[model samples]
Target: MNMDIKEIDGACHCGTVRLRVRLSDGLNSARRCTCSYCRMKGAVAVSADLGGVDVLSGADALAIYQFNTMSAKHYFCSKCGIYTHHKRRSNPNQYGVNAAILAGVSPFDFAAVPVMDGINHPSDHAGGPRVVGTLRFVASPGE
Candidate 1:
């Protein structure tokens, strides 16, 4: 859970798919998108260069899914049906690895995550992306 970590290992819920990822900006790149696919998939993703991720195991068990523009390629664990990572559509040179899959990480780790205006993608318009809203996490008094 150290923010200084630049590289980390990850796995799907079933551990069928494993990955060794070199983060582009440690955990600071973690974010959420308001796009149709991303909104529903609901994983807080962190940025990684195209070559930053290495499938350490169960590569064959990884299934890829693409939609609409077919630019981003979302990878999931075929066996456990857990989302692992995806080739980013906005920036093809990067991948958005599911933060929850990373060791000692959780969706609630961040106090607030900026929600990008994916409904109006930058590629679809001249202006760049905007923050539509913020997703916040407030922990209870006790466990």
Candidate 2:
């Protein structure tokens, strides 16, 4: 991918929730996590600072979900149940926005994405974060 685009506009599936964000490192910071919550949600996220994301519309329609340590705040569209972004538990200063929701972007855009060891989160461990594996996308024979 280009990795040059810094700002992106996005919305949930229902379009009731819209947002704009300035990526912390363009799309080069995109990645996935292995925690139980992340494993089930299965979103490829890109980094953004806490102040980088702005709710452009329907802020009241956005829903938040937190669990376990409750350090991370996951946001989604209550109407569509589409995950939009989350205040990163690994780095409270950063928010991991759903890459799939970004305009002109998709999880399949990357051939492979690094999978972080969210199961052994840095806050719970002595060492830093680890990359457990890579999630790869192999397109079918034809479109």
Candidate 3:
């Protein structure tokens, strides 16, 4: 996480459900998942700690979907069907927020987003893959 990461506002497609989330790494952890569900409903995710999200309005409009292990809770707007965020199955302590939902963040803001191995999830493995390579970001065409 960056030393100066800040909180930002986000909302569903219909402007019903609003949220204030303190981004963990200021979009540094943005990624795309290739799991069965994500493959169907495409959304880029950025990281936020479990305590970082605050539902500011229209909590009643929020809908949750849980499947498989039921550890990950995916949330969206009941009316708009806009994905908001989800409790990551791999790391229950962290959240994967919809990057496109943030005020100024866009999926295109990332030139290359690492696809996590969710199809073969880490939580299912006895001991996780030991080595993690460095993550390098390339600015989008115009930067």
Candidate 4:
């Protein structure tokens, strides 16, 4: 591990599963996806290498979910139902870490996040990459 790489600790909501992620690019790689499933889950993900994450415990408590082309493998805690990470479909060599699960990241920290064009994925479309929009989630009480 290089000096720039920082280790972050995280777990499921119920603390059933624990994780230690080696963030090579810190949190700067965080971005949002607009894929059908991703849009529904609404999580901002950060990039990580295949070897960056270690499931410290409760491996059996993790459940895998895959849909559509099934290239991206989404993992969540079966007990608490918290999405921890996923294997990238665009780049199988890399993994997408749940930015919300990483240490020190707050929901208010992000004012806007770039949404990827997962609807017309590069793998399935000929037009290449696209960004849908900058997503905002902040809201006041009772609208």
Candidate number with greatest lDDT: 2
- Candidate lDDT values, in order: 0.93, 0.94, 0.82, 0.82
**Per-residue alpha-carbon lDDT of candidate 1 for residues 44-75, written as tens digits (9 for 90 to 100):** 99999999999999999999999999988999
How many times do residue backbones clash in model 2? 0
- lDDT by residue for model 4 over 1-143, one digit each (tens)? 12244778877788888899987677766678878888888888877889998999999999999999989999999988999999989878778888778667754577777878988887887777678788787878895
Which stretch of 10 consecutive residues in model 1 shows the poorest summed lDDT? 122-131
Per-candidate TM-score against the hidden true structure:
0.97, 0.97, 0.85, 0.86
Question: What TM-score does model 1 achieve against the real structure?
Answer: 0.97
Q: What is the lDDT of residue 105 in candidate 3?
A: 76
Rank order by TM-score, top first?
Answer: 2, 1, 4, 3
lDDT of 3 at 85: 96
Query: What would you estimate as the lDDT of candidate 2?
Result: 0.94
State the lDDT at 40 in candidate 3: 75
* Shift in Å, residue 44, candidate 2: 0.2
What digit string (tens of lDDT, one per residue) describes model 3 on residues 1-143?
A: 23245788999999999999988887877777767998677788888999999999989999999999999999999999999999998878889999888887778666677777667777888765222222346665785
> How much is the lDDT of residue 142 in candidate 3?
83
TM-score of 2: 0.97
